[model samples]
Target: MTGEPILEVRGLCVDYGLGEQAVRAVTDATLTLHRGEVLGLAGESGSGKSTLAYALTRLLRAPGVITGGEVRFHGRDGSLDLLDADAAALRRVRWSRISVVFQSAMHALNPVARIDAQLTDALRAHRPELSAAQRTERAAELLRMVGISADRLRSHPHELSGGMRQRVMIAMALALDPEIVIMDEPTTALDVVTQREILTELMRLKDELGFAVVFITHDLSLLVELADTIAIMYAGRLVERGPARALFERPLHPYTAGLLDSFPPLHGARVRMEGIPGSPPALTALPPGCAFHPRCPSARERCRVDQPPTAAPAPAPAAATAAPAAADGERTAACWLIDADRETPARPARTPGSTP
Candidate 1:
């Protein structure tokens, strides 16, 4: 079901450097994050996924700036433009309304402090009503919520395993009961079993808490399983966005198709992963037109010269607009293939088990 958006990003552009030398780190990223939904941000390392996430959370550093566009956070009171908010306003917004779980949970944690104190610090800052004892109790409760024993609260950050620390990070992020959780590779350092456990716990928490999630990761297979909607980025622009099922079933953008082809299917016979031929282009010196065109197998002449406007989802034979509508969602993409008319010949499809 399509619900009212809790976070809306409009024409958001993040830039680095000055004058003519400026690099567009994130270009015209526009999308909506609905309450209680998880939107996966998937792409190569330099595709601007993390940059876009930082911009929305108003966490960009000086060299990295939001050059244009708006980050709107919808609250019961109304909408807040996070881009324009001051430090004081942002302090109140962070952890209270929106919290972030950075990629490296270990680094995010303080080596000097124990888990109990760390959790209490967040609780005391946001929930000032809680006394020291209450905060400790709450911290223990939070640890329990994340499947970690409260007894471990006395242990230092280094004492806990990577997965446990990540759970603690998640607990801290959820401490103030934020409306949105911006997680950047929450399961990156964990092993497969730990990752699955954490993901399962996260899904359970999402179902229980009903907070929206902006999940950033490069793992397309995990994303397909965990995310409700998937947003694929290439270079600095989004290449595809749609319901995970719809996107995996019939990806419109060539880049999107390539990413899917790269992931080996869990249930099927193992196949060699066909990586995109080239690495992501430099943000400072991106190619003209579609940034993904360089690695895109289906690139046409138009793809190299002109950026394509996001097209509607590909129309199913039953409906004239299914494909176009799939391409066109609150989560929009920027890829030429998605906009190409039916008369244009599609590139050869590569099945998962077939040789590319």
Candidate 2:
């Protein structure tokens, strides 16, 4: 369903400050987003989900720096290294090629400005060829595309409902018809029903527009339904990446299993759930080996002393069938437990209720 690679991130590292005092917020984070696919980035609060998003987009503010990484954005024209792209190149690509719908629409939108003016701002900047009347017409069309009345385009952000404002933000992001849209918790502030509406609208729009999405959220359950691919991050590092259904029904990493357990199933019998035991490690004072060792239920001595490299996990046994296992080379996990299990074929990988 997904097309060719559109955005590729490799060995991306982000720091919060200068050397000696710096906190590594994201370390060696890597993922590829294919055209027209929805890649969900999920983790608990302060897990670097947003940091990775901003860093890759070159939107990280002062005091936060991209210490290391390569962000290659492949457009229809050609490929460009986003991490090294100059201001002019970035401007040419931002709205017209890659757009961002930030976390909260209420805060992202200008409270004083009318929706039409705000929507047309990007068109004015990136699309100067359009006349004043043309830009206004396009703005009105965008509002209607997102299901908001064109008349509401004259309304101010404060005058609109939260859901309406969020829709307007989405409209602005789509105004230029960008190839990629990065949404950071776009529905976090809306009510459950409204959230579903917005998400359904988003998917429908994606189907019609064919733009790739990097959706960042802490809600694993939501991602399960919305994303084609899911990437799980813990302590600033990606712990797992695979097909959404595979990750949801048969999480290969203990951390992933813990996250899935935290959310009760919608159709299954109720069962007591024990979430991950401890807090995430401080970025400035991470443990010696794996940052997750302190909290991983299946952590071993080696896990406390030796960091595990990210690698493709061994294929699931033929008899195992909770969900379809990710094909070879299609799934990867960072966990010493996976390595241990691979070494001993007789030993089964630990699951949610299995003895660790």
Candidate 3:
């Protein structure tokens, strides 16, 4: 089980440029991650999930800038604000306290360098006291930890399979035993079998090492199986967040429900599934009030003019026989349809999809 807040983000905002040409990519996003927990961030392609992860780690590029909000890292020593941290402090925190496994392993890894060299580079930089032999031994051990044979240490990126390359990236991230691992679709382009193998290995490693994870992906089904808590993003705003089962079985937000319906169930009777109608609004020309109102099936007159604040969802009906309900204050959704005075639209019963 997870325990204690290790990371906290509040009102985080990110923009692509400056002045009149600036385009907001992320707005007023807030979430907390606990030690040994897996917090899944799920959204469509351009929903700013990657941007949020980059901003949290201070890895965003020049075109993208963090305009507001704070990220606090609670360490064994003390709490430090990531946004206000200086270069020296950030260096100390990055690999030692937090690490990242980027989206594309082939792009992230050096095509020309041997796997051993790539793995040991961080150790050499962070732990200069260790001798060359000691670093080599550590690198070999990292490979074995990720289920790769130590003999493959001499192999270059082009020599290994796609799955192996991704595993190497995971090994490198864990080189310093960081407390948090931010994975931005680490399993994106791999085959189904390979994805399952990697995910199983990752879960095992997380259990053994006790590291928290911020898993960002567009695969909601995969996250429903892997995540302890799931946060839904739409048009750069957090629309809903709750326990994985709770969110899957009873999503309070229309966008969350639409996402669940987009995937087909693995078992039982076959049924038609409809994708969310209409495209996401452009950040440069977003609709007024709620950004999702244009496509929301449950949209009301009030929803078109007033933005809904994130608040606790109303209790489920007694007849609902799904996952256990989250405790009060533990579940939140940003939709006017979930308001106490309003009647929530009845969701048609449908089977949930299984992980591919």
Candidate 4:
């Protein structure tokens, strides 16, 4: 509401079926992306993080439908309502205003085409006024932006290493000067060294381009280091969303605490990670009230009967809550243990927005 938000999502719901048996893949989700901010969407598999990403671009297909929501993309000339846009309108906006760098770069790039050709296609599609020479010049610059040599543009997808191919994917996404980039597990296929290198390069690129990023990954630790804000999802609903620092310091949600507990701290040696107990409930028959209630260690009778209202999870009392938050302020969380009416003692202090 303050700065010029580049993207706004409101009451977004994506359902997979019709009538009483309909399953909600994403439920009443809402968020905003400000210019140049990197917002991490973190959760375990089946939490609907990817669904939300695809929905933002109106990319959901078949039985998977955008049952309700408004995705408003703020553009230079005026605000564009993505949910209301026709096929042609959506096509024009897809790569030009918003782009995607998915998990598998090899599949994203055409194995038969040289990298230069793909990059050129993106340029010509978005900037038709540019001549072939001009587009080639721009393509070379993009390759350089992602730390690849311009000469690699002549190479085909099969000829490049996984990291190089991923970099090419990044370069392609950047070619159109999109206002936002959605990366779904961008570093998943590479080795540790390559992952770090790519992430470092991505951070640098983000700094240089000043484009908002929606980075989706289950790796919470990486997100903690790179994201400006974090949103934790559970069973297709955003259980918590707040400033990264605030969320990490005084995480208000039980689900978030479980995620934090599962990751080893950067300074510490590798410790045994205790994953959240039980798998996510089936979407077709999601639990009554809060979907997380079935697996939540802190779940109460009320939690089973009524969904917890989203609220700030305050630090425990000065003496009882262990050490006070390293930082001030709590964050928004969705858990019944934080309910003001609940009798459970104050939970331990954990960063609200800390990542995987």
Candidate 5:
């Protein structure tokens, strides 16, 4: 079910550096996070996945310039353009309206401070009206909500396990009950079992708290089970996006299919994992046409000559998925193979060695 848009990003673009040497980190990233929905963002390390998230929150530092785009944050009252908001306005909205959970909780958490002091810091800052006792009580309750015993609130970061540290970070992110939460690789260094437990708990908390989440990572397999919608990014642009199950069952783009194959199947006949070949293109010197053509097994002559339009999204085949409505809900891919007419209409390719 496509709910109302809580955050709408349109034609976003980000570049690093000035003039000729500029590297386009994120190009034309457009997506909407539905209210209380989980939108998964997956891509290679250098594919501009994290860059898009950081830029959207205006967390990018120098050399990372937001060349173009619009990031609108919607509330029940009205919408605010985050890109144009002044520092004062942004300070007012950030943490209170939209919070972030970084990749590593250890680094995000204060090493010296007790969990009790750390958790209540946000509440003390924005919510100054509450007394000290009230803030302490609220902090303890938040820890309990995330399945942690309130007694652990007295422990320092070094005393907690990796999983517990992550839970603390989650609790802090929800301190203000934000409408949206951006989690960037929140389970990176944890063990497989720990990762699964954390994701499961996070999903439960999301359902109970009613906050939209932007879960970014390179694990398509994990996302297939946890996410409601999945979007694949390659080289700085979104190549395919749709319902998680539909995209998993029948991917429209070759790159998307390759990512799905990268992970071993949990069931069904056993087969070798044929990971995507070659590395992602360098942003400063990207390929002429589609960025993924070099490693794409199904690439054609046209794929090497022209870039595909971001607007023309081919609907997934109806027979492949049971959720036709979700499949029809904004499924799109930036690949020439998706367009049936465009596939055969291109002129014959010129021979490399033969004279014209």
Candidate 6:
């Protein structure tokens, strides 16, 4: 069930200032998106999930810059490195080949524009060959795809509910049927039921349309349910990534484990929720060795002086169960605590008031 590689990222770094004072918001972040696959990125508020998405799509403004990286989009037209592409080059690749449903999607919609206009505008711009009738017809189809009625096409943003507004944004993103869709917290403000509905609708559309999705959110639990693969980011770096189930069942990184623990169980029994202790370090003055050492419960002396690269697949011991084999992308993490053969200490229970 592996889809073809639609997007590949390597050493993606993004900074927010000039040299000597630059704060690296996305450091050496790497991952892949296969066609029709859902890749979920989960992390803290500032772990750079949105930044990575913006950088990949070349949406970052002046203060944010892509310091280094390669973002290649493989298409029938052939592969193109988005990072190296000029404005015109990127313009051609974006939207038509890839589209983004930004965070707070409702806010992204034009307040004054009608739903039909907002959704069909991209089509008018990208597919000028289509006449007004064709654009309007296509817009209605897009709306229907997201479970919205064509009758609401003339409605304004203020008339729609939060969920419907988000749906309009999704429909607009699919206006051109792009190969890849990067969704940044598309369901952040919705209620649990709405979130589930929106996610379910998105998955159905993805299946019907055959588009790869890179869904970014802080909720690991949500990702586990929707994403085929999950990548955990930390302190501006991708600390761990693996199959969604694998990462959930036996997370390799302490941060990943803490993130999972932080989630309140939806069913079974109610328990006290303990989030990861200590705030993430400022990128300008990150810890010398591993950025996570200060907060990692299983961190050792080795983790204090030397940084660990995202490791290759580790051999599983006979008695211990290993993390599931990755479907396609890299299955690695930057934690020293996890080794398939070596006995790593179990993560310590959470402690309140723990600080850096």
lDDT of 2 by residue, 1-356 (tens): 48999999999999999979999999999999999999999999999999999998799998999999899999987999999999999989998999999999979999888888999999999989999999999999998898998989788898999999999999999999999999999998799899989999999999999999999999887888889899999999999999887776667788888887777654435567688898988887899988887887777799899988998876776565555544423888888776436331122233322211
Model 4 has an lDDT value of: 0.81
lDDT of 6 at 112: 94
- For candidate 6, what is the TM-score? 0.92
Best-performing candidate as measured by lDDT: 3
Write model 1 residue lDDT over 85-189, tens digit each, in one string.
999888988888999999899799999998899888878877888889999998999999999998998999999999999999999999988889999999987
Q: After superposition, how far is residue 238 of candidate 6 from its true place, in Å?
A: 0.4
Candidate 3 lDDT over 20-134, as tens digits, reads 9999999999999999999999989999999999999899998999999999999877899999999999999998889999999989999889999999999998999999999
Candidate 5, position 55, lDDT? 91
Q: Which stretches of candidate 1 lie over 4 Å from their true place?
A: 269-272, 319-332, 339-356
- Worst 10-residue stretch by lDDT in candidate 1? 347-356
Residue-level lDDT of model 6, residues 90-134, one tens digit each, is: 878888889999889667988998999988888888898999999
Stretches off by above 4 angstroms in model 2 are: 325-329, 339-356
Write one digit per residue (lDDT tens) for candidate 4, span 251-353. Answer: 5677786777776554434556666788888888788888888877778787788886666766556664333554334356777666344343233333433
Clash count per candidate: 12, 0, 0, 11, 0, 0
All candidates: TM-score = 0.91, 0.94, 0.95, 0.89, 0.92, 0.92
- Alpha carbon deviation, residue 247, candidate 1 (Å): 0.5
Model 5 lDDT at residue 165 = 97
Candidate topping TM-score: 3
TM-score of 3: 0.95
Give all candidate RMSDs, comma-separated.
3.4, 3.9, 1.8, 3.3, 7.5, 4.4
- Which parts of model 4 are misplaced by more than 4 Å? 1-3, 266-272, 312-330, 339-356
Tell me the whole-model lDDT of each prediction, alpha carbons only: 0.82, 0.86, 0.89, 0.81, 0.85, 0.84
Candidate 3 Cα outliers beyond 4 Å, as residue runs: 327-329, 340-353
Better of 2 and 4 by TM-score: 2
